[model samples]
Target chain A: MKLLEIKNLHASVAGKQILKGINLTINAGEVHAIMGPNGAGKSTLSAVITGHPMYEVSEGEILLNGKDLLSMNPEERAREGVFLSFQYPAEIPGVSMVNFMRTALNEKRKYHNLPQLSATEFLRLMREKKAMLAMGDKFANRAVNEGFSGGEKKKNEIFQMAMLQPVLQILDETDSGLDIDALRIVADGVNKLKSQDNASIVITHYQRLLDYIVPDFVHVLADGKIVETGTKDLALYLEEKGYVAYN
Target chain B: MCEEIVLKANESRDIVIVNEPNVRLRISQEEGSQLRLHIIDWQSADNDVHIEQVASNCVTEIYQVAYLKDNQKVTTHTNVRHLVGGGVSKQVLRFVLSEHAKGDFLGTLYIAKDAQKSCAEQSNRNLLLDDTATMRTRPQLEIYADDVQATHGATTGQLDENALFYMQQRGISRQAAERMLIVAFLSEAIETIRNEEQKEKLLNTIDSIL
Candidate 1:
């Protein structure tokens, strides 16, 4: 079934158009890779989908599981099973990672008419996810993303993704600031979280990440539109031939 | 003027005051006494406070918070003197100013010549929420005894705009974000209250005011 359908979407930031008439459809149990050069509006697409206040959707519609996605607020969209791992995940000082994740997970669960997890249950789940990501126990007590290394921050984001288990996960440049080792850990975490019930959108500039978290379909986003679409071979093609020719 | 009061060893005292203009208070602690004082002045006023630890094994905690709006002006002066040994004193003060409000804090810590092995700490933090708002803070320490421990720190800044936006983007309204920031900023001082009921009541009162 189609999970998300974006039809001729146009978005602008500060009254300047960035995404101009873009269309894409994503289904369950699939990984879609969005590759583009700088200023190609790859981040803009994610921001608009997440209902960022700075971006204004001028035209078209976004449907998540057959519901209007653009009309909901950011948290409501998140509760509706849309997750965006920000390019620069916010650093929240004085708010511990464990508390933040627990609150977020409980909020999502509450929205879905589920019972809130007890403290012991929550801690156990957190420990399981942390061990999966090879994160230490110290991270659970520290402030959310404060004083964390770049790789740790990215790993924390994936850990949060694992805990929330959203239906549609948007990885916005998750591989940007990670080393080879960190990149492998992050990809492994993402791979472990994948299932037949949900899907993912991997937004990146290089194809190295696509090699690990192989995309079922590769879409080249240029000037705010998906100009080319193909299988995994398209990612190889873009890697061999830079975006200069695509524009 | 200085007033000497006896707490009768092992007794706890809670003092709450709203300092009026040009108000001055001097308090001296006795042996084995415990004192929790809250000084809150939200009006346009100038105030001075002096606290002295004259006896051993005494516990002193002072909390001062000010919230000013409009074109209000406030200046606070504090002096903490540890004259004896084996005592502990903690002072925490915070100021939140908006509009064209102005604030000034002068805090002094003195470890006397014979006050040995005493632990004293003073912290002052100010938040400026508007461009026109201003704050000036000075923290002075005079430690004449080598065996005593004294620490003082002061900071003046604005709220974290990014954190505010992050909260706002999550469906929390701007007012809610401001409330959260204010509570977070003041929680450190509030947590020092040994009485849970009073702390919760004061927190709820502040929330209602906001």
Candidate 2:
């Protein structure tokens, strides 16, 4: 089943065009990798999809499960099971991880007409997800991403993806600052969370991450468009030849 | 110039002032005494607090939080003096203004020549929620003893837009996200209340208003 469809989508930031005439379709149980050089509009594509206020969709449309995704706000898009693992996750001081996650989970549940989880139940769920990410108990009490190491911040993003259980997950440069060990742990968490009913878009600049997550299809984005599409071997080929050809 | 409040030797007191249009109080502390004062204002108010540690081994704490809107105004003036050695003082103040409201804060800290081994810290943080709202903050400190440690900081600005978007992306409505940020900003002052029931009540009231 098709999970997301982007048709000739064009987006701009600060009144300057970034994504121009891009088309893509993602289906359930599929992992699509978007590889590109810097300034190729890779991050802009993810930002526009997640309804970031800074990016405006000037033309075309995006559909999630055949529903209009462009009409929703960021919060509404999130409640609809759209998640983006930010390249630079914002550090929010004084907001505890438990409180933040609980609010998010309950809001999604409310959107689905499900009952809210009690405090005990929510804590239990948090513990389960934290253990899945190999995070310690202290992680639950600390403020969200405040003073966290780079590796810890990436792990926190995956941990949130685990908690929210989003259907359309966009991993925007999630492996940017990870060491070898942190990368493996984050990849393992992503692999564990994959299901037949969900899909993922892994946006990265290197092929090292694909060796672990393994994408079904790889597309090379350049100059505000996807200029090339191929199997996983395309990432390996780009790693050897470099994006000099595309640029 | 209200009645002068005096703390005898080894005495401790926790005082809370809420929503008074005009507040004026003078407090004197003797040796080994402690005072915890909390001021909360929801409407327009002018507050003046003067505290003096006359003897050694005195401790003083002051916390204030004010939220105003719709042409409401609040002014807070605090003067704290340490006369002897081996004393500690801390002050935390916060104000949130919206619409056409205005806020002003003046904080003064003085340490006498004999007040060696004294430690003092003061911080004032304000938030302006609208374009028309305004805030002015001035923190003044004077330390006569070279051995004393004193620090003060003041800042006035709008809410963090990045933090707001982060919460919104996590499925929280914008209104709800803003409320959470505001409460977190003001929690530093409210957390200083020693009374559990009073603290909870104040939190609920602030939550409802936001």
Candidate 3:
């Protein structure tokens, strides 16, 4: 099934254009890697898809499962199974991880017309997801990302993804600050969560992450457009010959 | 009328005053006495709280939280005097104003010349939820004793926009996210209430109003 379709999408921030006439399509049961340099609008694509308030969609339309996504609010987009693992996850002090995850999960469930999980059921689900992510028991009690290390923050983001079970997950620069061990753990979690009914968009600058999460198609984004598309070998080739050619 | 109260030597007390309008109180602590005072207001109110540690080995704590909306206004004035050595006093005050609401806080901490080795701290934080809302905070500290430890700080800010957007992206509505953040902001003061039942009731009341 067609999970996501972006046609001629154009976006800007503060009246400055970032994503200029970009097009992409993703089907269920596939992993797509978007590789680019520092200023190639890679993060903007994720922002535009997740409906970040800072980025304004000036033109074009985004569709998820044949429905219009641009008309929805950020929360509505998230409840509709669109999740973006932020490159810099916000740290919210005094808001416990348990309360936050429960609220998000219950909100998603309410949107799907399902019953809200009870406290016990919610705690059980949290434990299950944390175990799946190889996270410790103390993680659920602390404030969301407060006083956490860089690696722990990234791990917590994946733990949230495991709990929310978003259909169209966008990993925006998930490997930016992670060490080799943290990267391996995060990649393993993503691989374990992959299934036939969900799709992922891995946005990264280095080819190191692509080796672990193995994208089905690799695309080079340059100056707000996907200039090249090829198989996984394209990532290796780009690793050798930098983005100098795309510029 | 101002009410007079005293904590006897070696006595301990936890006092919680919620939404009482035009509250005025004068409290004193004796040797080895402990006092925890919580002042929480959800509506427009004016409160005056004065506390003095008159003897050595006394402990005094004060926490105040107020949430006002519409055209409501709240004013709090606190004076904490450490008159003797070996005394400790701490105060935390917070307010959230919305719409055209207004908040004012004047906190004074004083340590007498002979009150050496006494410690006193006061903090006042406020949040203005709307452009038209106003907050005026004045934290005064006067320490005549050279050996005393005294600190005072005041700050006013709005909610964290980044935190709001992060929660929204996790399937929580903007309104819900806002409520969560507001509650979290005020919880710092509310958590200091030693009485769990009273704390729970106050939380429920604030939740319903918010």
Candidate 4:
């Protein structure tokens, strides 16, 4: 079933148009890779989908599981099972990761009319997720993303995605700034978290991450629009020929 | 009214001031006496605080925090005099101002000529949430003695905009994010309170206001 459908979506930041007219549909149990060069509006698409306040959607509609996503606020959209794993996770000093995750999970649970998890239950779940990501015990007590290494930040995002278990996950440049080992660990975490009931959108510049995640579909975003869409072979073709030929 | 209290050796005291104007408190600690004071500067028409350590080997700690808004002006003066040797004193003060509110702090730490081997530190931090708000912080340190460690620092600034945007991106509303940042800013002073009930009550009060 289609989990998200974006049609003729045009977005602008600071009154300057960035995403001209974009159309895409994502279904469950599928991984979609969006590849583009710098200034191709790859990040803008993610920001607009996540309802970042700086971006203004000038036209078109976005439907998440047949609901109007444009009508919901950022938090409401998140509670509705739309998660964006930011390229640069925020560093919140003095706010422990434990506290932040607990609050986020509880808030999402409350939106679904579920009872709050007890402290023991929450901690157990956190430990399990961290173990899956191969993170250390110290991550739970440290400030949220504060003083964390580059790889740790990306892994923490995936870990949060695991805990939240959103229906549609948007991985914005998750492979950037990651070494070979860190890339494998992050890809492994994402692979483990995948299931037939959910899907993901992997935004990246290189085909290396696509080799691991193996997107079922590849879309080339250029000049604020998706200009090409094809199977995994398209990613290899672009990697060999580069984006200039496509433009 | 004037109150003069002496803390005997190895004694500890917890003082709570809710409402008062023009308060002059003279507190002297004997040798080995430890004084932990939490001065809640809330709704004081006018407030003044004076403390001194007259004996050696004594420890003094003072924590003062105030939240003011709506054209209210609060002035807090703290004077710590270390007359003897081998004593330590620490003072931490913070104020959150909003609307047209005004806050002023006068902190004075004096180490006498013969007060050797003494350590004194004072820090005053203020947060101004509104453009019209004003804060004046004066940290005065008079150290006449050699071989003594003394330090004082004061800073006043507005909320961090980047932090606010970061929280907003995480699906937290702007208002909730602001409240969390303000609470975190004030928690520095609130964490020093030894009484659990008092700390919780003050926290709840601050939350309600926000």
Point to the candidate with the largest DockQ.
3
Indicate whether candidate 1 or candidate 3 has the larger TM-score: 3
**Segments of candidate 1 deviating more than 4 angstroms:** B1-23, B27-47, B51-62, B66-75, B80-91, B96-124, B127-161, B164-179, B194-210
Which candidate ranks first by lDDT, i.e. highest? 2
lDDT (Cα, tens digit) per residue for candidate 1, span A88-126: 887876666776677677777777799999999999999
Q: Is candidate 1 or candidate 3 better by lDDT?
A: 3
- Shift in Å, residue B99, candidate 4: 3.6
Candidate 2 ranges beyond 4 A from true positions: none
- lDDT string, candidate 2, A143-197, tens digits: 8999999999999999999999999999999999999999999999999989999
The local distance difference test score of each candidate is 0.84, 0.93, 0.92, 0.86
Better of 1 and 3 by DockQ: 3
Query: Model 3, range B163-185, lDDT digits (tens) per residue?
Result: 99999999999999999999998
Question: Model 3: which residue pairs collide?
Answer: none
Deviation from native of the Cα of residue B97 in model 4, angstroms: 3.0
Provide the DockQ value for model 4.
0.37
TM-scores for chain B, listed for all candidates: 0.88, 0.98, 0.97, 0.95
lDDT of 4 at A49: 86
What C-alpha lDDT, on a 0 to 100 scale, does residue B88 get in candidate 2? 97
Candidate 2 lDDT over residue span B1-210, tens digit each: 264899999999999988988999999999999999998998999999999999999999999999999999999999999999899999999999999999999999999998999999999999999899999999989889989999999989988888888888889989988888889889889988989999999999999988
How many backbone collisions does model 1 have?
0
Of the true interface contacts, each candidate retains a share of: 0.23, 0.63, 0.90, 0.23
